[model samples]
Target: MELVFATHNRNKFKEIEAMLPDHISLLSLDDIGCTEDIAETADTIDGNAILKAEYVRHRYGYNCFADDTGLEVDALAGAPGVYSARYAGDQKDDKANVAKLLEQLKDKESRKAHFKTVIALNLKNNENLFTGICEGKIIEERRGEKGFGYDPVFVPNGYDRTFAEMEMKEKAEISHRGKAFKALIDYLSK
Candidate 1:
């Protein structure tokens, strides 16, 4: 089957594509002539994911899927929730965002947080959504050099190191995005 992954970020594309079946021909926004930007004004992961997916499906008249992820820190009362991408500012600098998070939790002893992801599947006849989350604690200092976004500071529940510290395959097997996409895959496979 053919799927249009509604995202402009190559990292997202790579991560999702890596988990899909070989029989599926997945295309990114760029490959499908969808270079225009869309505002992510939604308040939740499911809303954002569905909004993006529906937008792409309607714009191209094709079946498409989209995902939205959020890193919620309990110390901040789920701060940077839906605004995870642009938490720092509109420019969305990764370093600055991480700096802001680190500073916010500087004095807090409860370093608990979780990564959640919502995947929206927009089919011609129906729309379906899948969600997943990984429970983990936030580290004071960033570690490792792999993965992207807030990976360096997020260590999965059972692991001692952050996502960036693990190999791509290992990370893919346990990452929040991985868990979410795997659920989506399971749903599709059925």
Candidate 2:
């Protein structure tokens, strides 16, 4: 089956593409020639995910799927929830965002956090939402050199290394995005 993955970020596109099964043929937004930025004006992950998926499905008349992820820190009371991408500023610098998170967490004893992902799938006959979450804690400092976003500062439960410290395969096995995409894959398989 052919489907459009509604995202402009090639990193996300590549990661997700690697996770998909062999029977599925996935195309990125660029692959389909949808270069226009789909505005994510939603206040929540569910809304944002659906917004992107709907845009591609309706505009291009193709079965499409989109995802939105957030790093919610318990100490910050779920701050940077919907604003995870631009947590630091409009520039959306990952380093700056991590620095801000670390600064806010400095001197705080409670470092609990979690990564959540929501996927919205738009098919010819139906649309649905899938969600996945990985419970973890925020580390004092960044670590490793792989992965992206807040991977360096997140340590999933029962693991000694951050996502950035692990290989792509290892991270994919445990990531929130992985879980959500797995659900989507299962649904499609059935």
- What is the lDDT of every predicted structure here? 0.88, 0.93
Model 1 score (lDDT) = 0.88
lDDT of 2 by residue, 1-190 (tens): 9999999888888899999899999999998999898999999989999999999998999999999999999989998888999999988899999999999999889999999999999998389999999999999999999988999999999999999999888888999999999999999999
Instruction: Show where candidate 2 strays beyond 4 Å.
Output: none
Q: How many residue pairs clash in each candidate?
A: 0, 0
Backbone clash total for model 2 is 0
lDDT of 2: 0.93
1-190 in candidate 1: lDDT tens per residue? 8899898988878878888898788989899898898778788888999999989988897789899999999999997888888889999787788889999999999889999999899999489988889999889999999888888898889999999899888988987789888988887888
Cα deviation in Å at residue 148, candidate 2?
0.5
- Model 1 spans with C-alpha error above 4 angstroms: none
